[model samples]
Target: MLSVRSKAVASALVVFAATPVSFASAGGFGDLGLGNTDWQVGGFVFVAPKYEGAKEYEVRGAPFIAPTGLDNGTSRVQFRGPDDLRFRVLEFSGFEAGPLVGWRFDRDDNDAARLRGLGDVDGGVVAGGYVAYRGGPVTPFVSYHHQVSGDDTGGLIRFGAEARAPLASGIFVLATLGASYADDEYMDAYFSVTPGQSAASVAGLAVYDAEAGIKDVYFGLTTDVPLSDVWTLKLSGRYSRLVGDASDSPIVEDENQFFGGLGLSYRFNID
Candidate 1:
């Protein structure tokens, strides 16, 4: 478990690195000449063939629940877009930040489990702003994510770099690296297991009160291969490790998660 001091220190490093790159390159939007700002909307659909759980007891913290969230085999659809507005916040660099919104539809067992304890924990919602730097082929940025669900609400801190490499034809490869954090509600909803509740494998072990807040620092790899000028094949894989009090919870002290997905996205550059 990472202490609060450690999390703060890590977050500081991320901010220090990502903010400068993002602010320094915020000016590139002017090249598009799409007015000072524009609106972009896009959607993605994906099929997660298998959403397997590594340990029925530790991963979910509840042995009664199934490992995989998708019991009947399901597909997911999500949508995200931003209004890119460029500003000169930093000295010589350009700054672009916008209001963003996203939605995830398609429910799974994990969704049900979380909802069992709350109002309507079904899918996911993301809202936030991103500041990007306009220098070079690789753009660095820092973004704040406010994700809310029926039962869970948390702030996500992302610090990473992205690169665009030109391929044969007009295609390009987009790469990204980032990490995030979650609050206790995020863990209690999905990972907490209570006594008297049913479990598939283990018993007597209940998640009475998590000793720490839920925190996960994840490393992710994603590639966007152009299918056409406006469409691309999006593939992403993320490996996450639990930290903080959540890691010390009696039910899931040793749980780690690796999740991956494949999807197709239609993107529009409004700016």
Candidate 2:
């Protein structure tokens, strides 16, 4: 049971660069509490491509990030994003630091015809930490993540900023802008094609070696419109543009990627 639940948690991490995992109960009050006053847990559905550059889209759904407030009965606070889940434990003034974990889905060659020779890049656990500063309306953050499981799954450094604004009728919006610098192992697994691979590809791919560089620049926006005290409608959209080594790869069919999702969630507050 523990192992299976662990797999679910890991699977949830692949939401954006994608571990946006969730937890629900089969019985009882139906919400898991993380020792915060405003903890929220809910589910949502989204549409996205199977792989980074692929054009085909699939409809999938998962639970949203159930955030726990970080105020330990003090003045400090915590923040969480879809890809990384960690409660800020260290804080000074407007700055905070904490560990981060995420999941990246494997690129299965069978998922697309163009990837016939590339093989599979095993999805793995991304473990790292983050540092951020809360400056009024905007929060700027930088994080380092490394794949700890699977062979040569690679790693990346992500820098981003988030801001929130409220609209009329209690509607709210969260906006994000970020970029990722992938390591050679990450670039190679997804973009590089070896001589042997080039020959094996049915797409007639050329041999290419992808080096470490900026993988992509991304922008995302999420809006929440309250339908009731316990229910909400969430609409999210994201765009990612592959750059540098990732863009020039032979296997890449599209350099501009997009995903959008609309979910109806029932938010339950922890008592």
Predicted model with the maximum TM-score: 2
Residue ranges of candidate 1 with Cα displaced over 4 Å: 1-92, 104-120, 147-149, 192-204, 208-214, 224-234, 246-271
Alpha-carbon deviation at 38 in model 2, angstroms: 7.5
lDDT of each structure? 0.38, 0.67
Q: Total clashes, candidate 2?
A: 5
Q: Tell how far residue 93 is off in model 1, in angstroms.
A: 1.9
TM-score of 1: 0.49
lDDT of 1 by residue, 124-181 (tens): 5556666666577666766655555433444555566666565556434445555444
- The Cα error of candidate 1 at residue 74, in Å, is 34
For candidate 1, the clash count comes to: 11
